[model samples]
Target: MATHTTFQFRRRMRPHRLALATLAACLGSGLTAPVCAQDAVQTVTISGRNSANAASVAGFGDIPVSRSPFSASVITTRQLADAGIGGLADITRLDAGITDAYNAPGYWGQLAVRGFTLENRSNYRRDGLPINAETVLPQANKQSLEVLKGTSGLQAGVSSPGGLVNLVVKRPTGTVRQLTLGWADDASLGAAIDLGDRSGAFGWRLNAAYDHLQPPTDASRGHSRLLALAVDAQVTPGLLVEAEIESSRQVQPSTPGFSVLGDRVPDAGASDPRTNLNQQPWRLPVVMAGRTGSLRLTQTLGKDLQLSLHAMRQRLDSDDRIAFPSGCSAEERFDRYCSDGTFDLYDFRSEGERRTTDALDVALSGRALALGLAHQFTAGLLFSRHEARFNRQAFNYVGTGRIGALVVTPADPSLTDENTDRDEKSTELRLQDLVVLTPEMSAWIGLRHSRLDRRSERTDGSRPIAYEQSFTTPWLALSHAVGPNGMAYASWGRGVETEVAPNRSRYANAGEALPALQSRQIEFGYKHRTALLDWTVAAFDIRRPTWSDLGPCDSGADGCVRAIDGSARHRGIEAEVEWRAGAWNLRGSAMALKARREGAADAAINGLRPTNVPASSLKVQAAYNVAYVPGLALLGFVTHEGRRMVLPDNSLDTPGWTRLDLALRYAQRLGSRQVVWRAGIDNVANARAWKEAPFQFGHAYLYPLQPRSLHVSAQMDL
Candidate 1:
């Protein structure tokens, strides 16, 4: 079978001038609507630090989460560092609806939200610009992580209905030099430095970190390094410019535990952690390097209008030389799946891949008047180009030998260079308005028009295959103040996801790019807010298309058959609460989901739960500051997820599990400088658990969870 890269959009027009013309037209239209000099536009700076319970993720900019007709969460840098969170998966655990899609620590960060997977192509952002989150993303230089749940089509042109995640970069604030030293139970040592300062009209911030961890399960090791720099200049009273650059590298030597067979789920104690299955450990470590740069400009065109422009470019390169357990041998026994594992381990050292991305966005926002009512409007244009190439091959490590045998380690192995390339581009125009219907009520209306083009080619001299499509998604919302501290809201929105072309082996229309899949959502919510507490309860229902793959057809000439049968329904209810009373802080979130596949080609599959989606989940955290012992605080947290289906047939499932963690923190002034110390124990119960993934390439895999781990760190201002 030929290799391929999907999930790409492409276009061929220059849109900067078009964007400018559109902006002018909007301004003209707004001027002639309803005149209201008293309701002129207000200059509002939107940032992650704008509010404690709000995020700037909507078309209308930052608004209190309670007032916005959506569900969202903000994880601050303080929360990240204080909790000793390692990656995106850990960060998203604060939200009950998000869970691990693939638990490949040190290699990738993948997640699912609200029973849907966040796609690698269009669901993640850095400082409001689309970015690839398939690889390791460093957290040391992030100010906050913001998330919008359920259909982010207006703010994000094409994205998963599960929602969107935006990482806010840290900017220069005040003069400070901080250093951190930490260690974990796995013989991991790490150090980081953060420096930032503002002077006159210019400010700069720099962050660097390096970590080395010895493999907890083998004699191998893993290493990672990161460097980030940002600078901003106040060129004039009305103009500001900022630039940022980031570079990261990682070398991972050990693969997380996996089940060799696609069907079996190993018993809790079936496999030992201290085992290395790869024949040659030195050749199995995956190495990755990535660099990103971005520039932004903001201009105050007038007191009532603000214009901003941003551009970003990124390049990522990876060398994937790892031992992958694809499936078990025909005669392998289920009980002995991992006991003395003998499977078709793929010596998957493909020629690796290189991905490049470029994006530009321009937006104008301000106050306007429509029908004698005060209104805030936002308009924007977005363009993005993405290209990727990968060399494909098959270097099989057959199941003939034992798990630890080195006899099959061939000398001078041959590699076949079959290159596959994909190109994607997208252009989008969006407009949104918030109208004050009355003193206690408001309506939000938004629309986005998007055009996408995608092309793919087998660089091994094959003709290119292309796809083009367009869509118009809309957002309608209503919010009303119920009382002094309460708000009620309802919303309707749409979402989109890219589809991969079927290969020759799978369909008669080989290499045909299917139309993008669509999803729609409706939600209702109530929120209560106060100086010391905030909570929200929301219920949502989403509908999306269902697809299936049928094996080889009887008539070989036509290849295989595929079908888009009907649709899937996902309904869920969620409740979230946060409290910060004097000397105490607490947070709790919970979700109950019912996700079922309907109208499948196999009638028996209907009404079954989608693979790997948990039906119920909850998370809670509490912290208390001890007044008697100044500068000291104690923290505790718990996370639990119900049993989830492990296969499309719902014949296999994993047991529900829970984890507990505890931590202590101390802060004090030493010699006019601040000093902090922290310690924590994760998985306090040392429970053994596994994460089930329904598909990777084409097979189901089981991921083992890490055992009890300990962490300690110290930081000091210099």
Candidate 2:
């Protein structure tokens, strides 16, 4: 590898120039004399590029980044491996506008994009089909991750206004067998096996892994396993079929999170993450289990026409026991002593949920001449159904005797049983077309008709509630070539999202679904493509409706509250750049945003900044290959997040923080086999920080982040 890298500084023609030169050469050869030679010569066409900036963007199939009307980012397998990313929390750091929203140990992959939380049910997809993301995700079996910023109404009819995430599964490539072993700080251990083979028209791939991780703060423990299989066959020269299935399970014992005290946010910077607040021995660890399957078929009708169909099904289940301190005493802020060193805690036990989902999509794509202009069009239909069942039992501690009153010991609470079930169905019809107006200009128009039907029921023998709604949204865009290497574009779109009903403890109409939220966005951007680099910059303004929980209702009922109406407006500018030059790879992104609530029923809360969203964020990454050592590379990254409001009223804020990460990788060839090794350290500066306080039930709950950690891994091919 050292001998293969010799360039210090090099310049080359851009991609646009290369294409123009190739076209000129072909024309100069004279088409009239190529008939005999063309019939005698054989040529092989390359499918996709192998460079970082040249790889095809995953979510849109064959569309390149330079041609997309909206801003999007792609994380390839090589980038994931170099950064040692193991979960969604780690992956979101790659984009400056993305952050963790509601992260609990062994629970799920919750995230926020562009200052708004991405809904678990409507904002996530696997291979273009909707899947449940309420539990731990299968990151080990994915080939790439794609994120589309702002509204994506043309593809996803009902979704959060922030953005959408799509996971691309690994497919059968070639015959190979590989095994890997990994170890990390805190007594963690992992092992995995990957195998693939092909014969004639059939091919198959399989992957399996198991991991056991000790608590990052000595207050938790976790165990997880995953298995994935994929099969594909060429039924004929113009037809193909594929199928995939996967299952995963995780068990983790977690410590309860810290909470605010009496309308005042606690000083999270002063608290130690090593402290164990909830030390009850009987509380069980959280457990999660999930299974999913998908099938797809494709048929080619002619040289420029194709038809595709897909269907998917998924199920997830979880059980948990939780205890956390709430409304701590203000006098002893350091120790949170109730009377001297003891406080009452919210003890939650016997919580469980089961979720099921089914999805189907059909699409047709082709090109034709319309109105004397060439046009590319795609028409599709989508249908999805989701069902959820939830159970919970909760209690609050109140001391009995004088000795036990002020200072209480940890004990199990007598919980009451409560059960509820919810069902949701969605159907959408979509059509989009790209028309060529001139040689260097184009126009895109799209429309979607969407419908949603929802219902909810409780076990108390009350009446069941149901709701139905419909919406029609449109999308429009225009683009023009700025120069040989640049393109400028502008777009406008609308979106819709479904809201889960308020909790029974919080509202009188607890199980009734609110009206679906409406959203709109407008953006302008520019993209540039070069031989070794690609860059994009965009500006956007977005608005959407939101709900806030007031303290309590006028009725005299314990734990009963009222829901307030409100809205949010966000404006931001973002830039991203990527490069893959010889012996050097670099990428970076930056974002600045102003996010605020408007039209709130409460005047004090109106015009206040949304909690947990930063005003500005930056991230940079660099990797370089060692010139003296064969197949050796060094990588480093820096991330910074601006100050964030920790309270809903914007009365308290947390200071800005920065984090550093470093890694080393090596690969070598020995005879007919290959060996690879990786070692990395996260949070190299040992920075202590808290991720965010997600809003729930009129309060923001605090979640502590992991401390500095290290991991090492090795792999061998047979």
Candidate 3:
């Protein structure tokens, strides 16, 4: 690692100092949002020092999470490092109000809130912009993470009513260099390096991290790599120029431990860690590899005015397939008729499943009416383009092995005989205004207009047509400082969504074809904070009763407007409590919510009730500095989820399950605080929890959560 420390550079701050400083910054910055810091911290003998409430991405944490009228969570960088977390899934699993975020039986996990389908906006961002939101993999170059809950048709331009997540990148500072190393159970290995330097009126930073992991089971494997480089320069004092780039890569594969009829459990000693889950693991046919590259440039015109031009392009591709015995018992498979049918033996697989995305967003913000009724106003033009392609092919059509299947056409293995492809593009423009009425009150207004056009590039006559969509939405919010550190806010907004064509095989489909409809929502919440604590509470309602269909309406039809007016309610209570003092910090949240859906003819439709949503959830975490131990810290966190039902057809409710986890860490010294040590265990109870439904598997074909396991990791500066 190459680090440069100058006179402007300072050392790191203590946990207490950082927390108090951050909160103060939030108050002075006009943002009123609160965040939970990571459990880890790295300091430079010449390098450490640091620094909230209803905070928005615009400034300090002055905005409450309840402002979204839904719920939001801010996980700080400090907390992440202290706890030795390496992925987004791990981070989210510990948050309240987030259900089954990644604790599902399958590898591809998602976020569910208040019984609403918030998958589209599941990914998160930083500084108000999405960083690695769409990547199915975890991001390594992040400084902080933000989760926004609600139908964000207002903030994101075009999105579902479910919610959105934002990951803030850890950029370089006007200081020196820092590094960290840690070790944990399961032979986990990790290392991180960050360097910053200032040249006259210019500053630059570089960061990199790598991890190698092996879970208890043979099927669980993980490898991650990340790097980031950025430069900050003041070209002419008034004209400051900055550029940043970041990249991350991850590869993991898990063996499907299918339960014997949902509750099937073999003797623990009889299980073979090395045994391939039947012939499935070997035939996984699931492989994903991709990389994302991003760049940003911003300019400052004045003290209260600045404009940032941002551009980012990402590429992702994956080949996935899963297969199970066609019948439950051997008799059922051959007889073709048996109670509780078998799994799909033909092993449906997707080949050449590739998706590529390119987005360009430009934003400009400054005080239009400098410091009077308004201090800073931000207006920006956003344009995002996404091109996704899908290619599907089947192998071993009727049996477990390739030889037993009939080769309709000899396998050329080079893209031939039976395949499909699809592509889509979207563009949007948004305007946001931040008006500060008085030092005690503030108001936020925003508007967005967007368009979507798509086409299906098929090898056959697959309705190769084009469709366009135009949308305009406006939002308004008011915030007042009740007590010196308390804030109350109310907001109202309209949300709009269109039919997405990538996930589904066909658009303008037949049978249940549905049209696009509009949705609207309104909410209110309050926040309170002191030097040692912060918390919030909110209530909201969202409804969309347009004759519409975004996906296969259970009948493989597109453009079908069969009275599909779907309305959902998000009424809940969210709160966070934190206490910080010398060497000790404790924080956590308790959340409760109710989500209801209307406008469905059949109670067993399977597509209603916001598939995979939980009614109640809770989480708690605590940390303590072992000043006596010098460089040693202790940590613990736990999360829980309430019962949820099945909604594949919006027909029935699935059995509910609860899960628990425990973690601990120890930090020592290495390279000027660059290197370190740590270890811990998860799923302490070794208990089982099903995060999703069985779909066709059965009424309760549980999605079994992970069994208790141990993991360890380490990092070295050099």
Q: Each candidate: how many clashes?
A: 5, 0, 76
> What ordering of candidates by lDDT runs from best to worst?
1, 2, 3
Model 1, 513-552: lDDT tens digits are: 6666788999999987665677889999998886666556
Q: Candidate 2: where is the Cα deviation over 4 Å?
A: 1-60, 261-270, 276-278, 328-343, 350-352, 392-415, 499-514, 548-552, 555-566, 580-582
CA RMSD of all predictions: 9.3, 7.8, 7.2
Error of 1 at 437 (Å): 1.0
lDDT of all predictions, in order shown? 0.71, 0.68, 0.53
- Cα lDDT tens digits for candidate 3, 67-142: 3233566666545544445555555455676665333322454565544545443134445654334344544456
lDDT of 2 by residue, 1-718 (tens): 1111100110000001112222222212221121121100111011012212221222233445566678776666556666767777666667897877767554576788888888888888888888778777867688778777888676677888888888888888768575655566667776666777888899898878787756465446678899999999999988889999999998876555555554455565666655555555555677888999999999888876789898999999887565555443444343222333344466666566889999998989776667776666788898999998886565645322121122344665665656667788989898887677765677888899998898877656454778888888788888776666677999999888766556565476565666767788999999776666768899999988877665556565644444437789999999888786766778788999999888887888778998888889898888777767766777787888887787776776767778898887666665644456667887797787666666654445666656777766554444
Cα deviation at 512, candidate 1, in Å, is 2.3
Q: What is the lDDT of candidate 2?
A: 0.68
Worst 10 residues of 1 by lDDT: 8-17
In TM-score terms, candidate 1 sits at 0.89
lDDT of 2 at 17: 13
How far does residue 669 in candidate 3 sit from its true spot (Å)? 6.2
Assess every candidate by TM-score: 0.89, 0.86, 0.78
Model with the higher lDDT, candidate 2 or 3: 2
